[model samples]
Target: MAERLLIGALKSGKNTKIVTLNGKKMTKMPSTLGKLPRLKTLDLQNNLIPKVCPEISALTQLTVLNLGNNLLEEVPEEMKYLTSLKTLHLFGNRICRIAPGACDGLQNLILLNLNNNQLTELPQEVNRLKSLTCLNINYNQLTSIPRELCFLEDLSELHLNYNQLICIPEEIKFLKKLQKLFLVRNNIEVLPEGICDLKKLRILDIAGNIIQIFPPRFQDLKLREFYCEENPLILMQPFAAKHQENIWSLKEITSRFVLNQLAEENPFLMNAIEHYPEVRSIISGGKNCAICGKFFLTVWLECVQFVPPSKNWKISKNLQLVPLRILLCSYKCFNQRDPNLFGISQE
Candidate 1:
């Protein structure tokens, strides 16, 4: 059998640096492979290996291990001894769990692929790989991303598509060096405004979701490839209609039409524009807080109706319809105002 020949060859070459037995239909790894203590690359992809043998730890010099397209159910904990490992490919497997300490000592790892598996959650220990730069966990059942993943400050590329994620955490902004991010085909309803802070992001895929709007600062990003198709993007309707093309520019997305569309969709914004035209004029003229007359990067609209005229007083019906609008830079400013006469809560 091919396994017998592979074991014979490994036993004969004790200093073998590379051993490839890809698509050999291997069910189990022979313990004789441990004799090659100098093995640096081992390729056993496209096999039936149910589990990795602990004896693999004897190959302490292993740097690249490929076990893709197999039936592996869990990562062997003994792999922690392979401190020299840099790239591990476990894609196309039935792996549902990873034993504790499986990645505890893998400090030298730079790329890891666990895609197309049944993993529901990632182990917290994966955060220990400070040297990791690329990671692929696409096509899994993950409902949420671990906040601990933010510790990978050196990471540049992260693929988390085809999962069941409902939201992307604000902590993702910590990946300052990230250049590519793929979140296609998820249940994501909203993207945190913090995503606009990823200055190095060039490719952003957010297709196939129910996202209605993007942060006002999103136009500041200098992305090269932006895939937002297939999403129910209601706020970007004006931009989408005008551009008909796949590519988008920052100017087109941040145009007055798009901004006006976003404001029209919000009840509080519409009320402020309709009832108090001065607030709209002030915002359109410049970026200063209408209430305190201070420069601000963020602001909210709060509207309050005037106290109703006394029954004895005579006033036109049209004059009583106007409401006072207050542009606040923060919630504290809005809280300082007296309650509305109509008891309508500030949004």
Candidate 2:
């Protein structure tokens, strides 16, 4: 019966571009599907097909392919032939592995849905999908994603929910165009400092994680919606404490002096830094005092300031105040800090 339908479809027209054979219960893809060279859309979802036939790769002009809810165990290598593909849906499959070169030919792919699969990790080749904007990998067993995934600068919406992800890469700041991030139901304990660099992020869902505190300057983000539930948040207990006197180590003293010298852009020191990569790295990691504006390394005072929710923000009504972590150069700066900035008690 499926063969007859394929034969009839072939005779339907010479310019036939769309084919809908979903739920046909066909166990194998008919080789005749290759005959539709100009086919732009192929719908073979909700079927028992175990794998995609290599013959389908002949459809070079295919733009959209739906193989959702199929018996596929892996993404076929032939998928690389669909260079013009823009949207590919493989959701609800048992796909556990993707051929390395499978993404090599998908340069124009925009939306990839790999949700509800058995994928444990994404291939580094995913970086080749430079035009991808929306990638859905929810409901998988991914514990850690390849850093290459963060190389997708055009990505705007990322769905990593229902996974075992313990942490997001600090390189996530590379997705400058990212707007919505869903990290719901993960084991993530901390958000990277680089996350604060995503100035375009607006909607964030970090609910159900074990996060106790947000990264520094997290309140600077102009978010419209914030969902942070089911996590153990620290209580806000405003109190007054005196900054204790502390002695600086020899290494700390040298690092502070070098950081100060680098700020003046001394030509000789700048050239010497090129030879000592460690020095350059330490200078880059230097933090400035919030009160005195002095650079410091390895030694600083940690504090928190409460941020009242803005009128335009759509935050949970249960949240009246949010704590933003801050760092100061020394105890002296902590002593002179604004009355609102409170030092976190180590006791």
Candidate 3:
């Protein structure tokens, strides 16, 4: 029936630039499609097309192709020859794999949607889409993102939600032009620190993960909206509690403890301890000394003693002394202390 309709359309004019056979119950694309040399847009969505017809590649002038909601097992490599193609939609398909060179000559492509597919990984040739501005691969079985994806310098929005990703690659910082990033509902345990370098980023959604800490400089970013709900995040609790919203601005995080706690838990700081032993020593020793009121970098001692009763105090049957502890930085400071003056005797 689809072939008959196309034959009728071709009989009217051989210079047809658009063909719409959507929902025509097409089990296979008719070879007669190759006869339209001036065709520019082809819509075969909601059809039963099991595979792409190799003859379709003869339509070099085709710019928009929609084969969504089909039974295609893979993307045809010959389709890459459609150099004038600008938009390709393969969503809602049974596609399990994309051949490596399947997108080699698609230099003019701008948008590619592969959402709701059975794909586990993207082809390396995807990086060759230098003109691509938006990519949607959500609701797939992707375990990881390819590093080559960061090479899409013009990409502004990326959707990877509802996947099995364990961690975001640090190379994501390379997406300098990225404005929005969607990574919700993954098994990600930690957010990569390099994400803080996205100067143009405005929205970041990492909800439903096991994130415990943010990047040390996360508060310094110019993000307009942030979402981290349903995660076991400890440092972001105060902000979330005060805002009472799933998405909030970074300016609302006014607590000093947030930065302090992040610095203590930062993996980069821990890694730096290996190269700077003195910094490790100071962090391990103590905070400050009671005698000199200076930071400690070496030995320190803590002394606990109970307060003694004074002459002005009234005698009570159930009185108890409270204990106080003092930190001494060095042995010399401890030796010079006057225990008797503090109401304690030293043997």
Candidate 4:
């Protein structure tokens, strides 16, 4: 029956650019599909196909392929030939792995769906899909994703919900065009401060995680939507009597001294940065205290300030208080902090 359908579809015309073979119980792809060289879209979803025939590679002009809800255990190696593909759906499959280089030729792929699969990790080669704008791999077994994915500068949306991820790399800040990010139901404890660098991020769903507070300047993001329910969020407490002396290690003191000199463009330190990349790296790691405006390395007092979202922002109704982190260079700086900023009780 499947063969006859393919034959009839072929007879429809040589210019047939679309074919839908959904719900077909075919165990394998009909070699007849190779005949439609000019086909731009093929829907083989809701099928029992356990594997794809090499004949699939002949459809070089294909732009969209849907192979979801199938019995496939891995991404077909033949996919590399679909160079013109813009959207590929392999969701709801048993796929646990993707053969290396299977995505090498999909340069124009804009959207990819691998949700509800068994993918434990994504291939580093996925960075090769330079044009990918949206990638969905939700409901997978991924414990971590390749930081190389952060290099996909054009990616606008990323979904990693229902995974076992403990933390995302700070490199995620490189996704400058990212708008919506969903990391629901993961094991994330603390979000990276770099996440605040994504200037275009507008919607974020981090519900069902164990996050305790937002990173500093988190409220600065012009988010239109935010979901952070079900987490053990730390609440701002009434003013408490907390006093601790600021103790700086010798390394911290020396690094701060060097950083100050570098800021003043000291000839020796400035020249060292030119010849010693490690020295440049250490200088780059310097962070300014929120209160004192002085550079500090490693040792700083952490505090939190509650910020309410602006009227235009849409956040969870239960989320009344947003904790914005603050780093102070010393106890004196902490004491001079704004009245609204509260120190986290170490009790």
Predicted candidate 2, C-alpha RMSD: 2.1
Candidate 4: regions farther than 4 A off = 239-242
TM-score of each prediction: 0.69, 0.92, 0.68, 0.94
* lDDT by residue for model 3 (70-119), tens: 99989878878888899999999998899767889888888898989988
* Shift in Å, residue 271, candidate 4: 1.0
Q: After superposition, how far is residue 291 of candidate 4 from its true place, in Å?
A: 0.5
On TM-score, the leading prediction is 4
Model 4 — which ten-residue stretch has the worst lDDT? 237-246
* C-alpha lDDT of candidate 4 relative to the true structure: 0.89
Q: Which candidate do you rate higher for lDDT, 2 or 3?
A: 2
Name the TM-score of candidate 3: 0.68
Cα lDDT of all candidates, in order?
0.72, 0.88, 0.73, 0.89
TM-score for predicted model 4 compared with the true structure: 0.94
> Arrange candidates by lDDT, highest first: which order?
4, 2, 3, 1
Off by over 4 Å in 2: 238-243, 345-347
Residue 22 in model 3: shift from native, Å? 1.0
Q: What is the C-alpha RMSD of each candidate to the true structure, in Å?
A: 17.3, 2.1, 16.9, 1.7
Which order, best to worst by TM-score? 4, 2, 1, 3
Supply the global lDDT for candidate 3.
Answer: 0.73
- Per-residue lDDT of candidate 2, residues 1-347 (tens digit): 66776887799765689999999998888888888899999999999989999888898999999999999999989999999999999999999999879999999999999999999888999999999999999999999989899999899999999999999999998999999999999999988988889989988889899987777778877788988888876668876665479789998998898887878787888888899887787778898777887788989888877777666678865887777777888877877889888777788
Comparison by lDDT, 3 against 4, better one: 4
Looking at model 3, how many pairs of residues clash?
0
